[model samples]
Target: MKFEIKRDRLLDGLSDVMKAVSSKTAIPILTGVKMDVSAEGVSLTGSDSDITIQTFIPAEEDGKQILQVSEGGSIVLQARVFSEIIRKLPTNEVEIEINGNFQTHIRSGKSEFHLIGLDPLDYPHLPDVQEDELFTIPADLLKTIIRETVFAVSSSETRPVLTGVHWAVKDGELVCVATDSHRLARRKTKLESVQDEEHNAVVPGRSLNELNKILDDSADPVEVVMTSQQVLFRSKNILFFSRLLEGNYPDTSRLIPSEYKTQVTVNGRALLQAIDRASLLAREERNNVVRFSANGSDEVEVSSNSPEVGKVEEQLLAEAIEGEELKISFSAKFMMDALKAIDGQDVVIQFTGAMRPFILRSALDDSILQLILPVRTY
Candidate 1:
């Protein structure tokens, strides 16, 4: 393909799609980026089988000519090399010309490079998911939801279903749930428009993390279209597709306790810092567990003990502490992660018992919840 494009625009497009290209992919050709030029504009695609990202640059946008089509064609160039070369090009405008035999030439300023390109016909076709099942949400809110829960997804692939974030929609509200069995996180939000029927899907956590990186944190809406095997997220200039995991997510409703025996409200930052300090000694013992016990009517003692290392103890005033005397030991890493996801100056921790799972919720926002199972120090 032959086209003279704005370098900044081209770099931005490449930077986003490059996340999908894996250097170690089994299909060698999949390591490259597909560039197609037509009368409309230029399109760049990158994929690693599980996730595919495509970005289009229009000939003109907002009265600025972003691309000039000298000749229309397509070519596949090594993603790493091509991307690096484009970034180093010394001009605002870059010209790309591809010969009939798939030889690609790129030029800018006084520098030129001739690189062998792959056959475009060999590129795998993107998933063909019809746009029947669709929904729209603000990109910023979607990103926020992902950040709040995606971390708890299991990194182990033994239970493939647990490696994805379970997404469900009902009555115009969407809930995202993720867990690694040791801990769980759930985030719920209301959609602006309602759907006729409920929908459920398990989307890979890795894919969602990559998608969040490219997503714009703005008020603009992102359209999501799903099929039996694939889900597509479309924004103004980007098209992202991911293959859904093939198993059903476990029923997690029963995992969250309906009642609590104890509840403690504390400054989120103070609690986080206490855990952070306690983990220093806990890590030395390879346990990374911290204990929280009610000291006074409205105070808590955070402490950790290690055989090889010294112990740490700190007292912090709880905003409100009530119910049965609370004493629970849990992974400081997990608790810290949940604390980071919560949004508020203070958070309430609801405990069923010292052996059962405990929950963390924002004092200001009721839509998000984080649950963690206590460790058996005994």
Candidate 2:
């Protein structure tokens, strides 16, 4: 195989697909990136069984020759070394050649390197995902959806399904929900291109985070194809694939209470800062617990205490407070995360009781909800 391609374009493709490469993959060939060069263009692919990423570069783009393929062939090169070499290449143009023995040669202005590549035949092929079960979402919206909820996904594998974010579409509304049992986050948005569809899939949070990094922060629509076992995200010349979690995601809708006994509206930034300060004292307590209590008709107190450390107390004026009096204790870190994900300047906290799960959400937006189970602090 022989090809000469623009170094900048090749680096872009390498950086994207490299997200899927893992050095400890059981299959030796999975650590390498597959390069397919044909008369039309060049394709780069990387995978580690769980997630696969591929990017393509056309031979000619905008009347400028970006790739010149002299022979049609395929080879798999060590992802780490090849990516480093291409990144540090001195020239703007790169020439790559592969011999029958899988010996790969890379050349740039005043620099040359030889790498032993694996046979492309030994590399695992990506699953043939069907396009029948598919929907489209804006790239920016998808990124937001991942960021708003992925943080709550369980890091422990005790319940495998909690490590994934549940995606469901109904009546043109797409909702992404994630929880670690202690905390939950849900985001709902209306789809512009996709029609009424009812589908539920739990996608690994790790894979979604990786896909989020590769996605462009643009409004361009991204094609989301869901298969029985795999999920595909296609945007422009890049494609991201991830294996779906096998277990059924628990019903999270019931966890959100239908009504609340206490409702308090406060400035989001002030509350976040107060909790941030309180967390310092509670950090040594090992739980990072911050206690909230309704102080008066128009104020709430945020405080924390540690036996070996100090105590912190802050009183914030609430925009409005109503319903029965309430007091709740929760993780400062979780509260901060919820505050960060909220979009509006004001935040609403609804409490069914001091023991029941409380909700932190935007004052004006109803599409995003964050729920946290209170800690039993005597």
| Top TM-score hit | 1
lDDT of 2 by residue, 1-378 (tens): 899999999999999999999999789899899999998999999999999999999999999999998888999999999999999999999999998799999999999999999989998988899887778898998998999999999999999999999988788878999999999999999877675667888999999999999999998889998877899999999989999998989888899999998899999999999999999889645688999999556889999988788899998999999898888899999999999999536999999998899998898888889999998998
In model 1, where do residues sit more than 4 Å from their true spots?
none
Q: For candidate 2, give the lDDT.
A: 0.92
User: What local lDDT score does residue 350 receive in model 2, on the 0 to 100 scale?
Assistant: 94
In candidate 2 the C-alpha lDDT for residue 265 amounts to: 95
lDDT (Cα, tens digit) per residue for candidate 1, span 1-378: 688999999999999999999999999999999998998898999999999999999999999999999899989999999999999999988999998799999999999999999999999998998977789999999999999999999999899999999989888888999999999999999988656778889999999999999999998899988777898999999999999988878889899999998889999999999999999999645569999998456789999998788899999999898888978899999999999999546999999999999999999889999999999898
Clashing pairs in 2: none
Q: Give the C-alpha lDDT of model 1.
A: 0.92
**What are the Cα lDDT values of the candidates?**
0.92, 0.92
State TM-scores per candidate.
0.98, 0.97
Model 2: lDDT of residue 183: 96
- Clash totals in order: 0, 0
